[model samples]
Structure formats: structure tokens, C-alpha cells
Target: MTSFALHLLRHGAPVLPGRLMGHTDGEPTAEGIAACAAQAADLGAAHLVSSDLLRARAAAEAIGTPILDPRWRELDFGAWDGLAPDRVDPDALAGFWADPDANPPPGGERWSELVARVSAALGALAPAPTLAVTHGGAIRAALHLLCGFEQHQLWALDLPYGVLVSLRVWPGARPTAQIMGLYP
Candidate 1:
């Protein structure tokens, strides 16, 4: 059984900060680029993967020529893609939070869908040490899908800009992952 190491790196700060930012491409801030590049330099993964979005792609590009994969994109928030938290319908947002899978945002991707997409990507990259430069939501989905953590339990895990979360994966038809560490 060969174990592989997977590092999930959150993209740096976006130009439009404090917004949902899903599927809405935005430039990375200067500090975000610098921080992600610096952190990426420290990671020595054989392969680099990233979301196709601008912020993640820019950071991944700073590290190396990453394999841009749209599967790594942030959760599609649809109508609420670029809106601030306060702007969305409060009841709808509450329903989304209460049960995201069963109650998606007006036109957003279901939580289960995000988990499934990220899980498939993780399963495909099972053999080598890979660095996935992605978003906080994707990382959260991985945690939920791979580690069996409940959605509510994920709130305790702080995923900040340029955060790195390493996992040891035993890849198979039903893959399993053990958390290695978190680098903020």
C-alpha cells in the first residue's frame, strides 16, 4: 500500500475581499501573491494542482506551472457568487447554513456536490505527492469527505489565506486520508 502526500493550499487574499467570491474571478492582492509564493516555495511536492480561477492560478503559477483543474474550483454560489454575506437573502442563507446539501443557496452548488467533486479529484491524484492550490470551501469539502468530519465540526478548522493542510492518503477504490499537519 503506497501512501501519498497531498497538500491543500488555500489561495491568497482576493482583490475583492469580504465577498463570497465563488466562480467570480478576481485578482489576487500583492500580499496574497507574495505570501502564497513564499509558502509554496517551502513545499516540495512533485506535482502542483490548482483551481482554474484567477486567484488560485496566480498563486500556483508563482510556485510552479500547476496542472489547472476546474474540479478544484470553489463552490459555485451561483446568483450569490460575488455578493457579500449581508447582501444575500437572510432566510435563504440561513437555510443554506442549516443544511447545505439539502438546501443549497438559490442557485448554488449543493454541499454534497462539492464534496463529490473534490473527492473525485483527490482519488485521481492518489499516487504522487501533489500540491493542490485551491479555496477554503474546497479544502473544507475535502475535510468533510475524506476525514468524515461533520460540516459543523469544520468551523473549528481555521483556513486562512495561504494556509496549507497536508494529508497522508491511502488511495484505493475507497481512499482514506490521515491529516499530517496544517501550516498557516
Candidate 2:
């Protein structure tokens, strides 16, 4: 099977950090954008894509002209979109952490829904050296689809701002990938 390289880079810190930033459309700090650009500088990506949201788009623009795609956006948090986790009901928060599909944030999407959208995005990629500037949740959703990780394992990824993970993708009707490297 022919394989191509795929890089998934998490967007940098948003101006409004430490909140449920999912689908919030906040901008990244200058330093945050710089950090992301510096990390991707040597990646030699032939194609670049980003979430249309400002936080990820800013970092993608710092690197190169990117194809802005809303499919790469973060999981929609809905009622909890911009609130601190503590502000949400503790039980509800715990339930979401434990089983996102079973207990998504009110008015938001299920984990399976995120996986489906991300799978579509992954399937649409052209076989090339590609980089996608996206959010932690989007990256995690991709991991779940590509790596077959359980929800419990996905939470442990610890993908911080500006982190990038490389994968070797054998794309086809059933695309699969081996995680090549993870750069913090």
C-alpha cells in the first residue's frame, strides 16, 4: 500500500485561554502564532489546511497560505462554549469526560459525530505531505478514527498548544495510519 505523510498540528494558545474554547472562534496570541510557525517551519509540508476559526487560522497563515476548512474546527461545546469547566455542573462535566458520546455537552455534538466529520476530512485529503492546523479535540477525534484509541485513552494525549503529530497514512476506502512522531 502506498503511504503518505500527514501532520496534525494543534493550534496555539487562544487570547481567551483556560476555557471551553470549542468553536469559540477566538484569536491566538502573537507569541502563540509565532510558536506554531516556528515548529512547522521545518516540516516541509506540501499542502496546508486549517480550521476556519481564528486561533488555528492565524497559526496556519503564519506558516503558509492554507485551505481553510470548517470541518477541521474544534468540537462544538454549545452551552459550555466559552465557560470555564468549573462553571459547568460537576456531574455533567465528569459525565462528558467519561463518555462524550453518551453525555455530550448540552446542545453540542456526540463523540461519534466528531469522529464522522473528521473521518470525512481525512478521507478527502490528497496523498501528499500535508499539515493541518486544528484544535485539540479535532486532533483527538482523528486519533480515535485513525489509531483506534478508546475514549479513555484519547484524554491522555496531552496535546498542548502548537504541538504537532506526524502520521504515515495508507489512504483508500479504509484509510489507516501509523503515528510516526509527536512533537511538543
Candidate 3:
């Protein structure tokens, strides 16, 4: 079995306020950029990857490594993209929570769609230690695949700003992850 390490890093805080930020290009805050630099210093991997979004890409760039920007961006919240979750229709939100895989956001990509794209991205990476800086939703999707957490359980995973979660991928098997919150 090919043993490869996959480090999943969530992006830092964005400059936008009360915005969903899905598919939206938003830069990270000054603190966010500093946090990324600090986190990058502790990372030992040579390979790096990032979402196309500016927030994630900035973080990846701060790592001082070549990045593979993939089209598998965060889940498209569509009309809800810039709105707070609480501001969205309650029924719509509930429907999404109850059956996320089936019920996509209004004009947004479904969980299943995101999963497929992310899985493909995972397959495209070199079978070596790699770092992927992305959004919380992407991290949650990876956790679902790695740890068998149901969609509803995704909420339980607290992905802090600039946090790093390490996972080992064995070919033809599920990945295993160890989440280290904001490692220095």
C-alpha cells in the first residue's frame, strides 16, 4: 500500500462581514495572514495545495511552496453565499441539515458534488506528504471520508483558523486524521 501523508489546513479568517463566503474571493485579515505564516513555519511537508479562493491561496503562498490550485473549491452557497446562516430561511437550512447529500443549497453545489470533486483532487496529488489549505466545509468533507462522520456530525468538528489536521492515506483504504488545533 502506498502510504502518503495529507495535511488539511483550514484557511484563516476573512475580511468579509456576515458573508457566507462560498465561491467568493475574500482576502484574509492581517491577523489571519500572520497566523498562516506562523503555522507554515511548523509544517514539514514540501508539497502544498490550495483552493482557488484568495483566502486559502494566500495561506498556501505564505508556506513558501509550490501550490496546485484545484477547481474543487468550497461548496457553492449560491444565493446564500453572502448571507449569514441565521439570515437564511429556516426551512431551507433545516432541509439542508436533514439531508445535505440530497438537498443542495438554492442554486448551490450539493455535498455529494463537493465530495466527488475533493476526492478527485485527492487522487490527483502526488503520493507524498502534501499540505492542502482550504475552507472549513472542505475540511469537514475530508473528515467525513476519513473518519466516517455522518453529514450531521460535520458540525462537531471545530476547525479553528489556521489549524492543521494531519491524515495518512493508504491506497485503496480510508484515510486517518489527527487534528492539532493551531499548532505552533
**Best candidate (score: TM-score):** 2
- Alpha-carbon lDDT, every model: 0.89, 0.91, 0.77
TM-score per candidate, chains pooled: 0.96, 0.98, 0.88
Task: Give the lDDT of residue 29 in candidate 1.
Answer: 95
RMSD of each: 1.1, 0.8, 2.2
Considering only N, C-alpha and C atoms within 3 Å, which residue pairs clash in candidate 1? none
Candidate 3's TM-score? 0.88
Ordering by lDDT? 2, 1, 3
Superposition-based RMSD of candidate 1 using all C-alpha atoms, in angstroms? 1.1
lDDT per residue for candidate 2 within 1-184, as digits (tens), equals 6899999999989888889998888979998999999889998889999999999999999999999998998999989999999899999999999999999999998888888889888988889999999999999988888878887899998999989999998888878889999999
Q: Model 2 RMSD to the real structure? A: 0.8
- Write model 3 residue lDDT over 25-130, tens digit each, in one string: 8878878867876776766776888897888888777776556565447788888886788889999888987887677789998998888778777767777888
TM-score of 1: 0.96
- Model 3, stretches more than 4 Å misplaced? 173-184
Model 2: CA > 4 A from native: none
Question: Which residue pairs of candidate 3 clash?
Answer: none
lDDT (10s digit) by residue, model 1, range 85-139: 9999999888888888888876889988998899888876848888999999999
Error of 3 at 181 (Å): 7.3
Clashes of each: 0, 0, 0
Model 1 ranges with Cα > 4 A deviation:
none
